[model samples]
Target: MLVFELVCNGTVNDILHGGNKAPLKLDLRLIIAAESAQGLAYLHSQAHMKIWHGSFQPANILLDQNFMPKIAGFGISRLITEDKEHTCNVIGDLSYMDPVYLETGLLTLKSDVYSFGVVILELISRNKPTHSVNNRLVRRFLEVHKEGKKATELFDKEIAVTMADLEILDCLAVIAVECLNLDVDQRPTMTDVAERLLMLNRSRRSQAV
Candidate 1:
């Protein structure tokens, strides 16, 4: 028999959009992104063996009473060595899965980066990955970013209310876009993503003080 500890606060999705009308504040969002990035970074680099989270999505991200997140749904994960992309049957949600993996049927650590990037986008917009014109939160952000513009309209208005908040949101958007690059080689490592997110959180909190 197996057991799982129930997360009191439910998933990040439940907290933010599961019939809860209250706003998901900027501070909490930053904490979630920072902590989640660090957690994934560990699986990618700090773990004794590299682990691929074949199903990294918002729904799998469980939150405790304190709203701290835990990554779940590891039944499909695989172990990999240095710079190797595991080949397996197509798995994971289309909206969050890496396109490269879909196209090549090869999963790399960067594929996880792609999924995390979608999670970051969700944290920013409060929009489900399936929401939007092209049914992809990533495409909208990329289009806006490529035009050298901020996708403020795509953000959760509650969090992006002020100029300061928008600045922080834009920084996150930059990180998400970087993770979402089509060229797997161009994607930053989870280590880099974690550091950037951690630094952003620290910088924002310092300014708020």
Candidate 2:
């Protein structure tokens, strides 16, 4: 028999899709994002074995009673050696799959980074990655950001807008852009990703006081 701890809340997908209902606060969202990042960082670097969550999506992240994040759905995860840069027969959610992997049948840690970037974009935009207006959420976001538009324009109104919030969100947006870089070598590591989110979250909290 298998026993599982109860996760009172649903996945991030449920919260994002819960229209007309109360949405998650900005800080809470940031917390969730940070916790998820930490979890991924552990998998990618801090763990006894390096792991790649090939299917890192919002649906795969479970929330506990306190709204803390617990990464789930590792059915497709891979354990890799330090020297292994890529793998074959690439597999993952279509919307979150790294384009390089799609083209070369290679899976790298950066592939997971790209997927996480899409998740971050979903948290900010409240848009489904697979249901994007431009077919691909990352491309749309990159195009818009390249136009010199404020990143706040991409965010959902669930979080109240303040100058400080916008500043932090912008910082996150920049991180997201780097994560989605077409060149896998240009993407930040999971550790870098986690640190950046935590710093932004801390800054926001300090400003709130």
Top model by TM-score, which number? 1
Write one digit per residue (lDDT tens) for candidate 2, span 1-209. 99998887888887787554455788888998899999999998988978878889988889889989899988666444457756565666888878887778677788889988988888887888873334466777898789978766678766637877777777778888899999999999999999989888888888889
lDDT of each: 0.86, 0.82
Candidate 1 residue-wise lDDT at 119: 91
Tell me each candidate's RMSD, in Å, in order: 2.4, 2.4
Please, what is the TM-score per model?
A: 0.91, 0.90
Could you give candidate 1's per-residue lDDT for residues 1-209 as a string of tens digits? 99988799888878767986466799999999899889999998989988888678888889988889999888667444456665657766888888888878787789989999999999989888873336567888999999999889999988888889999999999999999999999999999999999999999989989
How big is the positional error of residue 201 in model 1, measured in Å on the Cα after superposition? Answer: 0.5
Show model 1 residue runs off by greater than 4 Å: 1-4, 78-85, 131-134
